[model samples]
Target chain A: MVLRRFLPALPPLLAFAGILAIWELLSLYFGLDGLPPPSVALRQVPVILTDPQSLFDIVDSLRRMAIGIVLALVFAIPVGLWMGRSRFAAAFFNPLLSVIYPVPKAALMPIIMLWLGVGDASKILVIFLGVTLPLIYHSYQGSRAVEEKLLWSAAAMGMQPPARLARIVLPAALPEILVGCRTALVLGLITMVTSEMIARQTGIGNLVFQSLEMGIYDTVYAMIVIIGALGFILDVLFERLRGWLVGWAEPAQSIIVGST
Target chain B: MIRFRQKQRSFTFERGFRLERGLALAFAIAASTAGLTAASAQTIPTIRVGWTVPAEDAKYWMMKRPQEFPNLGKKYNVEWVQFQGTAQMVQAMAAGALDCSTQGVLSLAQGAASAGLQTYIVAQHVGEKAPESFSVYWAVKDDSPIKSVKDFKGKTIGLNVLGTGIWGPLAIALKKNGIDPDKDVKLVEAAFPTQEDAIRTGRLDVGVLNQPFAARAEAKGGLRKVFAISEEIPDIVHILEACSKTFVDKNPELAALYVQDLTAGMGKALANRDETLKIVTEIFKAPVAVFDPFYFKTRASSDAPLGSADFARDPGAAANYDGIQKMFKLYYDVGMLPKQLDVKDFKHAKIFAPLKP
Candidate 1:
């Protein structure tokens, strides 16, 4: 059984291994005159890690990610729930959202700097704004997807509004809500880097932009690898956390001994 | 009776067809004649000049606002757009998106030379003591033990980039003070706007800042300058207004017009410094008063006719070029450049070439 399960994943693993090999070969073949090879970029990893500033960068990025995710959730879920439940609220907000949702967040950097100065507050707020729209849209959709029958049954039973929301609607909407949270989590991470790119003094985005400007291609790739790894870790951790909290919904299976 | 009706129908069809053909022929001839007249009509030529300095900041040259490349518009058609950095403006010049631009002398020199763009210094914004006017300063936290350029050894010094403007000036200044800027100090790269914040947050031990940013840092009280490029490298040329050789070659008259307009702008800039400050205020959208320290309203007249003497005449040029040669040599030494990029490789036939009136 172990062999069967493990063997089935080998193809994907082999494919990834092939890609890494190709990357290494290409960098070495091309030489470091233009773009540094993977090995050279990797060599800088130890140096990048040993420095306290690099660690501080990681911590700062995570801190921003946390703030952004928290803000997204706080605003998205409540507004999403209300709009999902109330037709009037949806009508009022939909038109405004349709107009604003497509505006790029990078364009807001100059204005944000003018208002907030070049500080952490502006970076965080821009990330929050970028992540919130997608989260709210997704969660709002999820909440609306809740079965009308379930809501109708709860209402017919004379259940209090709070009890109905907590028991019937929220649980039914949990899976979709989690999906929206996942999207927001990823968007928060991306915008955190993007905001730093535009009007920031520190953080991985600023570091990468600085390195590229100075033509230090090695540092750029190294920073990119680190950021990608951080994103992956965040995604995995969120997945595990969501699993633990909402694991009760995991379908249980039963087997009948028809042979016996 | 049927035959008579058929004949009448044929006559009606023939008359109608002839009438339609005549109308179509008349319309086609009239449209072609009208188009021929329109094709020969002359349209006024419009020139767009890109400068990193905001129009308000550049108000002395202003006809009105930052975007309006005045005098040129009044005399000839010209629009000036301002950017926050020389890098962007140079990029525009490289892409043929700009007709002319004003960039830091160092940046414009390197860019023009490399891109094979014929560039000439049209005007100068002169300042007192090159080193004092344009030096990179080392600043440490008020309570920190870092006291001098020598103390910066083994510590990271924040600069915009390596092997560029600040790198060269800082290297010479540091070496003069008895330290190898390259080997002793770690140059940390940061954007111009972020230098103050980096210094304030204690992320950077010292930073090399220019006028507006430097002034902003001084106001915050956390940063105190330990040394400046101006004090060490006095009378340094920071920026020059330039245009491409191709542009000048293609439109010499227009190029001359540009130089005249720039000279006019510089004159206007110095004549009405207070009014210019108001212009800078509107362009940057920052407080109008931010203009007071970054720009020396009166000191700009130090260089006569705006485009005065050759850089060869300036002592700061000795240090500046020596520093650039050293930087180029470092790049060659470290295999950063494929071959030694002599100063000649980066210059054109018209480098500091006079803009004829």
Candidate 2:
């Protein structure tokens, strides 16, 4: 029974190990200076973590990302839900969102910095813009799929419109909203790195580029490993939260496909 | 029932219209207040300058050692913006987001010829000094059999980009050596930081390096230099400090003060190498070891006395119009520029006039 309790974690661990093995084999076979092997890269991970400045930059980046994600969630969910419920709201916002969706959020960094100086505000704003679209999209999907009969029943029971949206639609749509949040989390990290690279300010992205500029290949790869690990950990924790929040809902069909 | 549904739809439309109008009014009020605040705060004109490489650009030092530049925050305030590359800086300038920036001659020509951006060459940032100064280096693995430029034929070459400062000189060198740059060699775009590793790993037969990267590669000591860019284009103006003509014309006094402060700051920084390196280290957040060997090395020629400390920037000296003209012509010849530009037309003579003795 104890073994069974821990069994669910085994596949991911095995898969991660398999990936490392493949990476090591490839790096050794290529023997390229630009492409350091996993062992060499992993050794530098501790060095990076130990460096106070690098650690601070990374933590600062995470702080900006968290704030951006929270801001996006606060703003995007209501707009998305309103659009899902009212045709007018959807019509009014769809065109604007469509225009913005195609533009890479990182590309807006230079223009945004011109308006709002090259500080935390600009970086956080870029991350927020990047994460908002997916959240809005998923929330719209979830809220739109909420049972019409349930909403009608709540209305007959004298529930106000706002109360019905909060208590009924939100919980019903939590699963899809979480999925959107998962995608937004990934996008937020991407935008954070990309904007920092463009701005060349203090952040993990700046550290990565600075290391690249200095020809510190091991440090570059080490940063990659750290970011990848962060993404993996965040995704796993989010999956647990999703399971807890929507345990009553049917389990999503697991498809064997490429990783997100 | 149909009449009642129609009435409900009409009421919803009215509510939506009213909400939209209210939001529009709020946005207008907020925007006007922000504009007013910005206008009130602009006591002194702020020159938004963009820089890429901190170790190379003097603006980085000027901003770091504010005391050395007395004109800063008094005559004009400087707002420094760090960019990833010249391409991004060019975009920022075109967008009117940047007032002044460090630009390569290729980009300067491209900006004027292709984008029609009226940018004036304000001062020289970096240039080659013959026989001693090397602007760029082409290197191969120490064990590679390739000995000279002729051997570069049919071999892969790594460059930071295809048609920037390095490409024109390299093309001239290759063509002079009877190797067609286009048909004979395969040019791959790799970042400067990765070029050393790329060469060492045998991925590239030759990797081009400049300044700090060249210093790092030399310290590592496995790469052999095939040729230097200065050998082909002697005394080539590698980079120039350029500003939009509009900015220079509108605020000539501010522009002049900025140039004076920059020149003075560079002089002071070069005068005290150890202190300057400390500031640079703090700015880059990297070790002083990265820039110690070659950051401010100026070769002693007959014209330029020993310990004169050019540091590849001579803001007080005359603009190298001949060298710049040659570069513009080369860029046009190589199709990097859409049209030929007269170098003299783009020189901000008014701003540099005060520097004349």
RMSD to truth, every model:
24.5, 9.1
Each model's TM-score for chain A is 0.86, 0.89
lDDT of 1 at A46: 72
How much does candidate 1 score in TM-score? 0.46
B67-135, model 2: which lDDT tens digit per residue?
666678777788776778887778678767788887888887887777788887777667776655645
Write model 1 residue lDDT over A1-260, tens digit each, in one string.
88997998899789868867898888776543236777777776776677676677667766666665666666776787778888998998889889878988766865665566445667777888888887778767877987887778778989887776556655566656778878887778788887876444347675566455334567778888788777788889878866654544445444544433
In order, what DockQ does each candidate have?
A: 0.01, 0.14
Give iRMSD, candidate 2: 15.0
Using TM-score as the measure, the top candidate is 2
Q: Write the per-residue lDDT of candidate 1 for residues B1-357, one digit (tens) a residue.
A: 112111111112123333345336535654553343242333556565655433223323453543546445555565554444675566656666566766665566556546655555444443335422334466777887888777877887888765555455567667777887657877888765566667766778887665555555566566677766555545555555666667767876776666655555555555665876776543332455454655542224443211111122221111234444455565454334445556554343433322334
Q: After superposition, how far is residue A111 of candidate 2 from its true place, in Å?
A: 7.1
Residues A82-169, model 2: lDDT tens digits? 8899999999999999999999999888888767666677888999999999999998999999888888988999999998776677
Flag regions of model 2 displaced more than 4 Å. Answer: A1-32, A36-56, A63-67, A86-125, A159-163, A229-260, B1-45, B73-75, B142-147, B177-179, B219-222, B298-311, B315-319, B353-357
In order, how many clashes per candidate?
A: 23, 0
Clashing pairs in 2: none
